[model samples]
Target: MAVRHLGEFVVIVCLTLVTSGSSYAEQLPNVVFILADDYGFNDVGYHGRLHGSAILTPNLDRLAGEGVKLENYYVQPICSPTRSQLMSGRYQIHTGLQHGVIRPPQPNCLPLDEVTLPQKLKENGYATNMVGKWHIGFYLDACLPTERGFDSYFGYLIGAEDYYTHMRSYNVGSKTLSGYDLHANKTTVYQYKGQYSTHLFTNKTIDVIERHDKTKPLFIYLAYQAVHFPLEVPDSYMDPYMNITDKNRRTYAGMVSCMDEGVGNVTRALKEAGLYDNTIIIFSTDNGGPIQSGANNWPLRGSKGSLWEGGIHGVGFVHSPLLPTSVKGTVNHELIHVSDWLPTIVAGIAGGALNGTKPLDGYNVWSSISGTASSPRKEILHNIDSLYIAPEILPSYFDGEDFLWRFLARVLEDKFDTSIRAALRVGDWKIKTGPDASASDVWQPPAESGLHTIYPIEKPNQKVWLFNITADPLERTDLSGKYPDVVDEFLQRLEEYYKGSVPVRYPDPDLEADPALHGGSWGPWE
Candidate 1:
């Protein structure tokens, strides 16, 4: 066994496999990582079993039923953080992306020195291609996908954009500026102006699959911009969801269905290209859904921007014909984070080397996914966001009859500063510290269900919370009062993580990033 130190995590590599001849390398599996933006926990069809939900996802449900469903999967609370972690196989704190999504005007992106998953796969002879959203960064050519080890790239540089026009608008100081964001290998292409992005991305992926050579393994990162904000979809797609009374939800469901159909089409393309047997398709959401925008994380608390279970507990699954017969169609409850994908695919499946990369925070969880062994990971550092601002407490909270006594009791019992928005999970225990009032913190059932649950509002001063997440997945009960020792231990762990974290990389919006200065398209401006 070759022991490779990856920052704080020690990765044990098998020398025999690493030194093997071409015969061993030829057996590597083709990987297709499909990432959905702002997808909710209870939005998929498989979860419809719980409440007879109306949201439809036939292709996604079929994919999960044929593969292993990751019931305990986790992702960051927002887009850029999860993408950075997935690409670098490191936590957001290590990458200095611990704050928020990469703004369109910020001159910030994934560090240039970081070895991305695609770059590593390419070194092992895989053909790396990317389609759809690339939100990590775009202030320089070095930050573009093609420059970062991808053989070819087709996508938008920033996050949200108009689905049809492919236009994105950003506030540059006092003026709002808009530009076309669609790109093909660093070139802005205007031919796709009227094409729907979901279908457009799907077609491009199929083209890649159809043109791929069978001799070499393939890697595709299809990061769909579906089901995010703006809530736009073709009328035909929304026709089936007329029963959904909420207009935003109806559009949202249509967007999900469109993405699902694209998945099915891509799967068909893989089969037609004779790559189905050796391909591994992994589907995951970038973060939890924002309930205010027609998304629901029913029975789970919080939305996209918070550290609550609903915000970080993501939807994920691995679909491949190569999975063990016994593990097929089963749910794996082992803990798995988004960062684990790099090692799980690059090292575990592709027989690649991680020798030159920086220390990785991810673990190779292939055995756990394959039902051969338990997950090597037991703890997940969800985040330590120093820049997070808790919502202002309402005056009603202070005006309550027993507010004085309750406030005193909380002040005395609090073990850590709640003003710092941070969360950590160890074993079954999860601790949250900081003031979080995201309004979307309550459970949001499907709009069509006409159901709502009232949750207690957090007091302005109350910050620390402890919960045995496994026992109370809904987060309805805070055990900070019942377990002082657990709270102390978790707080200590958070402090340790904070001490090692890099300073946040959030930069002020650069005026140079204005698309008006760059041919009416968002691209490298610095």
Candidate 2:
């Protein structure tokens, strides 16, 4: 084994640590997850996204104040991957889904067999309710929320929707305002008439909480479709920001504020129902925002679909009344990834939640929150898209494959620079490996030159190399040639990490296909 790989193993080992059945702290706590669409890192009051802006997110601000605020957090580069990671506790590729924010008649959705977080929680006696967007994938109806484990489901299977109309269009035959219906026990019993996406979803969640059997706790995965594209502010929120200068951004801010209010409503409902203290509400975005969604991500470059920090890095947290003082208001600096949600939540609920799967990828931050331990990921891989050399359940299999292909073709024309495009930041050192020269300009490796080398560390002077990320967060300078030994080690780790991905099976097919009935979709980003 190479010394660099050895160093990487050491880093991962320190992360593994030792654990047993339960830590006593892993008690039964109700779970509520609010996933914002196209949300930026600094958008909320806690993160200063709305600090000097006209946007007012008082609800989220209050939530952060009452609970803990997480700074060092991450999701996939786009919506699909994040939902994939959120549900299966595995990497996007492993889950068998590709494409972020799929169009209606969306193809190649999440595969069946992946054990969802709700299913795991259900095993330990938690009623699961999923309301709002279910954008994991929708080639078929099986991908819906209820099929995956939600006892009750209400929301569009696609990514985003027209708030007022409860209907929108992606194409001629593929347009339908009414989203699919998902149910666990009785189909008609769970049937509902969808309203303005946000309000309707929130009302359903409140109803679920209000009517849930308090005996067995509950897990509500509230995936909000707010603040995404096809931007529209409900009449209520639009009145305030409607008067702003930038029409798009004004409505965008209004959408964000309305979403924040929705979150507040849910939290208020929890408190009103007396479930607030016992519940652990996790807040995060499915992915970053796009150009049309509003430029909330300033300091960070890129947005939504791009693989930059602004695209993959979004705000997130696990708010529980039981959070230890050490972890509260503290930004966990350890390395973390998307797949950890399953085990992390399990770790919180302990015996009350699940016992089927071992620690997959994500670490339970609770112990670290208690100041008893820290996470292992220091230098993390924040790839937004699937790194699959090939894809399973490819688009060719779907009847709508041709349509999706055309969409992809149109999107590729204005594609971002892949060559010299993507970058990586390991502590202070940053290495940028853009879209392959061959990928865009057909620059062949070896035929020209493509050797793995490190940056900022010099041993054998190499010209095109890496740099110190801390001193130059923008990664303006290339010091790979300046430092050979250090560069070589870091380069090796990147190689192995890219080459290594333990694939997990897709979730149950019925669950995956349940939400896509009647060819429903969430516009461009859905």
Candidate 3:
């Protein structure tokens, strides 16, 4: 049970935060969290993919040199779950959304009960604004970004929308909300007349910052939609890609460059607003880039949707005025997870409830990485939640096609609790298992003869893999055969986490009555 401290008071005061061990600073620097969509680790100039390893982003490169580069950052294998962890500070399993698209009336989406980062920060006097793709939970007035604590919400409620069309498949109470609503909270904000997703999101960010309550600080959650899918890039901007060898990749490069410029614009906005000094800015992507769609996350295998290191290991740069010049440009290789953002930002602001802060599954990565202190994370956790079918379990997941997407979608559509999978990574080691209980979709023998891999037993269901990710990041080695003890130990931890866990649900909030109030509810969606 959470002990609610009716700290419902919203106070905005202008003062400096000093660390002389002398006085307490009243005003906190504005925080801007820029989460880009489908940006691979090697896509930026800082990480070295910009301009096809040719042209460079002087601004972004300079930003990394000014901030701390997180060398071992890990997000979810996909987007919505990553957003859930970033906002709720909970593991993906804790939230209802285990896999696939998060639509309205999605009983599996983040239960209306989880408290989001903005909800916590808003209580501390910052005006919160969210603009760009929000895949955390359902889509509706109740499940929208504002309901999750953002003062202003602008962005698509779905995964990927057409760059020009701004159209997407949707469902409300099992019915879709298409066409008009896309413009309501998404595509139309900031007078986004005809700009592509990358450009419009950037401009909206500036507008939010410019129109912010200056007397009070601001917390801007800018999750941009670019380089994700539908190959949406303005012809004028993408025509340059024709000169490149690969058409798809060339276009991807153009989209990424546009996102880089968008980021550049935000920083300039900070400077213009005179908030750059004390501001704390973070830039990261929701997941790995698309391998089929011209993504270059080499040296690491797998793309968006898989459990491979490439799928989860994205890049991060933290630039806060609080750090010393020496700490700047210092790369911290600590294993940091996305769940850490909420608690860390809350701690930094000296706001909300940290007393019984649920021993968050994530650490305040900045504290140690920024030289405030030093410590190393023992293990990290990630989940694809890709398979939550019911009634019966399938023996294998299709490595290539998305027939599985439709299949898994139906498992929930038909209401069945058929799968459970969890993982624990001790250093570079990992373990995962499928739910063995349930009367749902049992795997039938393949008419073809070559389905089984190792022992060649035609079993109903089994999916397990262990790897020394640091040594074999692509996960091709399959160290499970060689390191049984390492696998056993991590597997024990994973099981313990599963058996000892309680389900978490997103809470509905009376935001109109009190914009910062948070509540949640949870039940068996199947």
| Number of the top TM-score candidate | 1
Candidate 3 lDDT at 222 equals 88
lDDT of 2: 0.58
State every prediction's TM-score relative to the real structure: 0.91, 0.73, 0.76
Q: Each candidate: what lDDT?
A: 0.86, 0.58, 0.63
| Model 1 accuracy (lDDT, Cα) | 0.86
Best by lDDT: 1
Ranking by lDDT: 1, 3, 2
lDDT of 3 at 238: 63
Q: Give per-residue CA lDDT, model 1, range 444-470, as digits (tens).
A: 778888787567656547778889999
lDDT of 3 at 511: 21
Residues 87-171 of candidate 2 have per-residue lDDT tens digits of 8776654454533344454454666767788888888777888877777765544666667787887666665556665554444
lDDT (Cα, tens digit) per residue for candidate 3, span 191-282: 45356778877888899878876678789998988878877676665665555665666677778777778888999998897777657888
Q: Which scores better on TM-score, 1 or 3?
A: 1
